[model samples]
Target chain A: MSIEGSSPKSLFDKLWERHVVVEETAEAPAVLYIDLHLIHEVTSPQAFSVLEGRGVKVRRPDKTFGTLDHSTPTLPANDRGELPYATPEAKSQVERLIENCAEHGIELLNMGDPRRGIVHVIGPELGLTQPGKTIVCGDSHTSTHGAFGALAFGIGTTEVGHVLATQCVLQRKPKSMRVVFDGLLPEGVGAKDMALAMIAQIGADGGQGYAIEFAGEAVRALSMEARMTLCNMSIEAGARFGMIAPDETTFEWLHGRDYVPKGLAWNEALADWTDLRSEIGAHFDKEVHVDATKIRPMITYGVSPDAAAPVDALAPEPHSEAEKHAADYMKFNAGKPFHDVAVDRVFIGSCTNSRLSDLREAAAVMRGRKVKEGVVALIVPGSEAVKHAAEAEKLHEVFLAAGAEWREPGCSMCIAMNGDSGKPGELVVSTSNRNFIGRQGKGVRTVLASPATAAASAIEGHIADPRPYLFAKESA
Target chain B: MSFDPIKTLTSRTVVLSQENIDTDQIIPARFLTTTVKDGLGASAFYDWRYDEDGRPKNSSVFNGVDPETHKILVAGSNFGCGSSREHAPWALADFGFRAVISSDIADIFKSNAQKNGLLPVEVDEETHKKLLASPGAQVTIDLETCEVTFGDGEKGSFPIEAFARRCLLDGVDPLGHLINQMPAIEDYERQR
Candidate 1:
């Protein structure tokens, strides 16, 4: 069981070696069996159609889970939305998923079910996302499930169809990139800040063609929610996926859950998790280290996630070819101070930052303030579970009282897949990952900021420091 | 449907033109819901070839061109940017684009295209400019010689990693081509 003599193997190496189907060759790509396949309403239709066209059924239906989240309307507790069930598009898509799942006998956590939420959020909450699992979804944010020590990745519809029919995917194993974040984060900094800071250090395409393994003290100490945020932005950095090794934090999050094994089986699972860490001396193709303490409250100022600046720093001056190119496209003034930059809107939601904690933080800032005039602030929770949790804490009331539009759970305004979008030329201070041009809407500029910054920006109508609120609260 | 692979690509002169066109833009998020066959051909250049009116915009390079006649698409640097949607290549293939000439391509998009039967040809900037200037210039793409011949009989050499080239010449996808290597996989499994 030892790896290459007495040297200890990193959890990544162990899991990869354990799941090695065969070494890649010139003609043949390695085929790795998937442990879990999470599907949403958006991307499963074509995959199902492909299967039907081929007269093929899902190969491992038992390993699959389907749900409706991306397009589900989040209505207030008192008033249900106009749509009785899912939206027409969502309903049709969900129907396709349900029919396909039934035909294949796969589990479907349809909308309105307590377990149904954003595919990323629900997977971990229900304990279906576990260590050493190979999780694939049709959404890029599928990397969010890798927080549970699983090798999770997103696939397109064609690949989804391939997986449905074969239970395995033809994949070229990615080179491992280790991103080690050490030391404790300062107050006002959260997982979103950490992820943004990482993107800031490494340009958006730094991890291209690589699978990032997030390690070190900071990553280890992150809660399951925070870990999900960390892995959620793997695609933002152009990495195939980002993963963390399973530990007590991961097991604790999974325990007592309905889907998780209990009693004697739990202990057996723990023993299995012990082997999930990367071995000492295990080699990585690339290694990046970011000092967590050095990271500040971050905000993206341009088209890409990497086009970011610290809360206290001015907008970056592009000296390099890549920076100049991105800056020209983004129309951002080089070396210009970003402190007084005006914002037309503030959005707090996405697979990256729409959790209960993110809502609570934004609520804390909006408790006694109203959204500034001409500034539209929207708070969309990541999932129904998160929305429910926010209601339980009265965070929604705080947001609504502050004139913020508290919308339902979904990837609202994240990529503007649905009707939720920002107007062209509007400057949006978003908590979502990626500030790329037209990422929110055509010509709508996005400035990715922390939740506190987003809330403050909504209140002030410009980028402002969140530390003052935390400091004032501390003094009180 | 089968054609002579040896005689098919007589001209290797592929033109390269668009920049940072992502896979999502190629197939778009909407078309992703339909069956591959139903959605692939018409949706290849959905956004690029049409105006907001859904009419074929006259300015679109791909618009109004006969599919069989337009065998090559010259694209600018960093083409195929967004999500790793393999439908990009499927759409490209269905549109009768045998090869995409670009300075560079997104990693996943390139791999997907190569895996599925589209030849992604990478060339230098100067060479790309020259190919673009050669309007309606059909290049003799010889899979056997692995070279692209311009209209002027100038041949520009390009490297297609041995395996990928072999797969393209054989007219088989990577997955289908791998059937020949099952014995090695079986032996490895036995050892394990």
Candidate 2:
């Protein structure tokens, strides 16, 4: 894969070079080919309208896939079988995607289809997200696919249209950054904790204008699902692209999935993917190393994701106007430990931590414990596949027994677009990615944490560390 | 949809001096259900600009300024950090903003702004500080020279890709240009 006599290249450099249809220059960007374009109800409508207005058919319908998320509700119907859409427009968005996909001859995982789920969640589940491919979606968490060692990123609707019409996107080469995690992660800390810890070390904008390659001992030790969780939040660190080199774990997780190649082709794909890692002496524009062992179960106390501290730490004193503003909005005692921060709601699902393992983690904490009285806890699986798998394991009974609502799969309560959100002024410990102001709901204070921490917090009615519950189970 | 060509614009600026002002603050996810891309101007920064009762907030800078005259929005560093929603830029353009100047702009947002005809200008920190300190300061953006002229004759050059710049100047639709390269795309796909 190396160019003749050229220096050893990083993983990102290899992926970028492999996808270039036209080289970048002073006058123009490189026209990079898109290997997979994941579309969903919320972002694809306008892109489809633009395509219809331009009077062009999709260039490669085979490479395009659609799913319904965001606008679709997590609540199922009663006797009438109505979908409880948040609005008429929300319902129409889902209907429009079905129509658009039918017209364009693209495959769509429609509602009630077992394969349907959050766009990011379903991509990897279906094996459409493969190593060395360039994946783009209108959703920022498109970086989720990069865990397979692909060059995946989020694109605006305009670029979505460009990819639909031409199968190529105009992209300038971004700088490369390697974020290395030193040492093994502690017992209670998971990938979500690692991600928040990294964002805290680097400011929210630390990885801007660069493609971040997550490397190091802890990252290598993470399971495929955990890797996706880490890469999924790369956008929060302001990196458009985040990836890991594909290895045995990646191939094992992807094997025999719906769209992945068969036996002979699988061997060929494996050989190509094995070469996808960065070679020695590869150059990086920047390198950051964080001590993973020191990264306890983390939680964000401010509107920004980087406003994070360990679960047992005291609420930080405000340093800037922004920090003061965040403190006022979040309403935490300045010097009190987060353990005293009472929780009003708990949301244990999002593209960030709604996979099977994430559900199992939450279920383990809730197996015999009860959600504190008056605290509304909702457990929404990421996808229907995740839902069915969890149901087979009877995870729903554990959540329901603990007084948490077990809901259908979608991007529920994550963006608050699907009629699932915290009430105004309520404090919610959520496993979702962003904790932006009013993101969960107007005037709502969002504390981002891992599934285990969220589940433990729900049980205690406060921000409780997960180590006690996890250790108790190990001893049992 | 071809945007109106933006060659030069002179306008007073509205400043939101908050770092990491993400797209959710620009246009919340709830207002994104529309199949078309129009009328989002009213909902741009809905939570910031309006109260729960749907009335404009008295403290919001948006309510104090006239969109027609204040076409330049000067924001703090790392503006438009989260989400890949083009509605963020569409809402800005629909609200009559022609250019956004920041010390650091998120990569996807800067791309979306250019395609939708809203200019994204990234200047030096000193210039950004000056702009942030002076709200409603008259600013001039000249795409011809890729420079932003502001208070007291101070100026800073911003970078825009040459292709994006040409497309903005011509008011040509980039999708059309990309569509014309269908043969090249097909050839590349076939070789792969």
Minimal lDDT window, size 10, model 2 chain A: A467-476
Residue A268 in candidate 1, Cα distance off native in Å: 1.3
Q: Residue by residue across A1-476, what tens digits does model 1's lDDT show?
A: 55565666666666666555555677556766677898876767767875676577676788788887655555533454344433355556556777777788888876566667778877887889889888888777788888888989888665677667766666767788999998988887878889989987986667777889999888988888899999998877778678999888888889998778899998998999878888777789899999998888888876667777787788778776556766665556666667678889999998788888888888888888889999999899877778888999999999988999988777767766555778867889998876755667655778898788899889888887777776566422
Which 10 successive residues of model 1 chain B have the least lDDT summed?
B1-10
Q: Provide the overall lDDT of each model, using Cα atoms, as 2-decimal numbers.
A: 0.74, 0.92
TM-score for predicted model 1 compared with the true structure: 0.86
User: Residue A72 error for model 2, in Å?
Assistant: 0.8
Give stretches of model 2 more than 4 Å off.
A1-5, A474-476
Chain B TM-score of candidate number 2: 0.96
